[model samples]
Target: MNLEKILAISGKPGLYVLKVQTRTGFVAESLTDGKKITVNLKSNVSLLSEISIYTYEGEKPLTEVMQRIAVKENKGQAISHKEDNAKLTAYFKEILPEYDEERVYPSDIKKVLNWYNTLQAKGLVTDEAPAATSTSEEIAAEEPVKKAPAKKAKAKKEE
Candidate 1:
């Protein structure tokens, strides 16, 4: 399905799963439908590991992170972070044309789009289903693992 279909489903309250594989590891899980979007990174991964986003009609998502941004506004990192977020938001806006601008603030809009692009950049969203294929080398590669001596069958013959 395309972005429109996905967004349409997102408009309702339900559960959806998005399976993805990034450079780091595989991420597969289901999300609870709500008014706002949220992103959560898995354990043993950096900031880029995992993320979630919900629509803005509900409560504000990423409340803590936004608070942190507020506290660290003067720090050098804030400028760079904001710039990066802006880039992400702009990219998202280009892809998601249906986003409600009036309901979404510029900063929040950036966060939502950033979350979406991060998924794309991490190879989460795909236009096609994953394919499994066989190769000549794979057959040979399987021989060794399959050829390990089998255990003796249980003796079941009636005497």
Candidate 2:
């Protein structure tokens, strides 16, 4: 799934899809309400693609974490974010055992789950990489490859 265009603005309720780019910043439509709003450059906006969770090894990108959850849940919605902290922690541990409890708080886990559900509900979550390859392969098979022209040999220098 591509989250590059999806954003999580601080102090905002739900995720937003980036729409038109403005001179100052850009306009975005809320995934929950479908209302458009202009987000200024100074605003605390984070692309979902840029978010990451702290882990024992290092930080794991949100995309990879979401993909793990998607696979674990069979591409279905994860447990509700409203679930208790213990439950949430357990679930996240099962998915990412090395997640740093100190750095990655319960609230962060909830947000990730909630965002995943929202994205899945909007049909934005997808296993498209493989499908894209198959389509590309099909196109390649249908089209013939064009070969580059061979260069002419240069004449030998005279003694």
Candidate 3:
């Protein structure tokens, strides 16, 4: 998937939280891959903290790595986290697209390319070129306007 599609679904990958019917009891879950980690509201689950990590093997979902890391090791305490689109964009750029004609669509790849551009513009990811700057009336108010280099001067010399 492209960065935009990822960003659109990023919110879905956080710790699931809910209150029990009593309203006094609460349940929270850290879901990684297909695993479910449950914790109580009164206490914290270090092993259950959910954070987003990026990987680009292209064979497995990012969630798979998360699950592996979760089950193999405690990963310390769980720190609730949401995916940062900018980080995801940088990751995407670092992992060049290997779209095969039979495997993926050009338009799908283009969407990712566009997403990368958007992230770069937002300063979430760094590209070779510096970010573009724009001047508006509000900005011009702060500085004196300079006349365009006088074409007449050059024209007179030519004459």
| Best candidate, TM-score | 2
> 1 or 2: which has the higher lDDT?
2
lDDT of 3 by residue, 1-159 (tens): 112112212224433323232344344332223233333345432221222332233443333333332333243212212235455433333343432334433333343434333333343332233223556975688788988886754435544
Q: After superposition, how far is residue 57 of candidate 1 from its true place, in Å?
A: 15
Which residue ranges in model 3 land beyond 4 Å of their true spot? 1-6, 9-98, 126-159
Candidates sorted by lDDT, best first? 2, 1, 3
Runs in model 1 deviating more than 4 A are 1-81, 84-99, 129-159
**lDDT comparing candidate 2 with the true structure:** 0.92
**What's the ranking of the predictions by TM-score, best on top?**
2, 1, 3
lDDT for 96 (candidate 1): 41
Which has the higher TM-score value, candidate number 2 or candidate number 3? 2
lDDT tens digits by residue: candidate 1, 53-130: 344443322322333333333211222224665664554355344445565566655544344433333344444422
lDDT of each: 0.39, 0.92, 0.34
| Residue-wise C-alpha lDDT for candidate 2, range 1-159, written one tens digit per residue | 888889999999999999999899999999998999999999999999888999999999898899999999999989999999999999999999999999988999999999999999999889753222357778889998898899899989999
What count of clashes does model 1 give? 7
